[model samples]
Target: MSQDIHRITQATLDKLREEHHHLTTVGRTEIARVIEAARSLGDLSENGDYHAAKDEQGKMEARIRQIDTVIRNHEIVERDGEATEVSYASIVAVVYDG
Candidate 1:
């Protein structure tokens, strides 16, 4: 992952933290349960369910790592409500003549 710092809102950061918690806890447990169930289904080489569960687990772990990186490398920012110019996290809209 890039080492560049991310500027994110406190709300966004909180949401990310919540997601990280869920993935590390409930998500991991659920995937493990699925894998165990799949493992009992017979031959490992022919078990499509086992392979699919493993693949899903890998993807979830990757996302957890990504969220962890962002949570670690981010700078929390608040919107400048009084500012007259567009800035970081500012919503923008445009209109043009057709």
Candidate 2:
């Protein structure tokens, strides 16, 4: 399988790394705390807070994995000069999926 490519600047890379680190460390710790607190409250079958915390934890983990993939397989492109050749890929494609 081919690896997905992501061209990013150093600053962007640094920011992504920071976010990943924060989520993995402090964020994970906080979620675990919430889950523990929720678990202490009666039955596990009808624990809404516990389920919600688990759901949030899953989403957060997915995000961390996404950031990890980019960090692992991405390339840093330094733009030092003006563009000489214009092609279809030369134009930046901005799509708002949200």
Candidate 3:
């Protein structure tokens, strides 16, 4: 039996790409600051700040890898040129009954 990968809409893909960029840039900078602060505390072995920063770095790297994988496998959905129809990048709000 083979499992099929779920198809993601273009809007969803864009959102994911944006989030990935944010993580790669802003998130990485913040983590660097944390590590710098920890280093300024003198010793790393006994520094809680250092440990926390390292953990956060690991998580950020993991998310970056996941996002890269998704992007690599992404299939861009084609859009119809009709104004009356909703397309891949169109934002539609629908009421949900849960």
Candidate 4:
């Protein structure tokens, strides 16, 4: 079996890359710091702050992994093409007969 590939704009790819980098680095670092701080407060059995921080970290890590997969599996394509094809992003609405 072969994995399916998708096309993405360079801008989108760049944005996802930035998010992945920040999530893996800054996001993880900040969460770890928060966890450490919460741990310092003592009583892990009923530590709401610690649990919340851990939950947030899990969500962020999941997003990071998702973006990583997108960056790896998709191909970046230029959006400068002259295709006249209508897309959701380029759709315009005009009210006819007000």
Report the number of backbone clashes for model 2.
Answer: 0
TM-score of each: 0.90, 0.79, 0.70, 0.80
Candidate 4 Cα RMSD (Å): 2.6
Sort every candidate by lDDT, greatest first: 1, 2, 3, 4
Model 2 lDDT per residue over 1-98, tens place: 88889888787899999999999999999999999999999798999999999999999999999999999988887654566664322545568998
lDDT of 4 by residue, 11-54 (tens): 78888988888888899999999999999999999999999999
Cα RMSDs of all predictions?
A: 1.8, 5.4, 4.8, 2.6
Using alpha carbons, what is the TM-score of model 2?
A: 0.79
**lDDT tens string, model 3, 24-84?**
9999999999899899999888999899999999999999988887787777766655557
The model with the greatest lDDT is 1
- lDDT to native, each model: 0.94, 0.88, 0.84, 0.83
Q: Which residue pairs does candidate 1 place in steric collision?
A: none
- Error at 82, model 2, angstroms: 5.2
Q: List the residue pairs that clash in candidate 3.
A: none
**What lDDT score goes with residue 1 in model 2?**
81
Clashes per model (N, Cα, C within 3 A): 0, 0, 0, 0
Candidates 1 and 3: which is better by TM-score?
Answer: 1
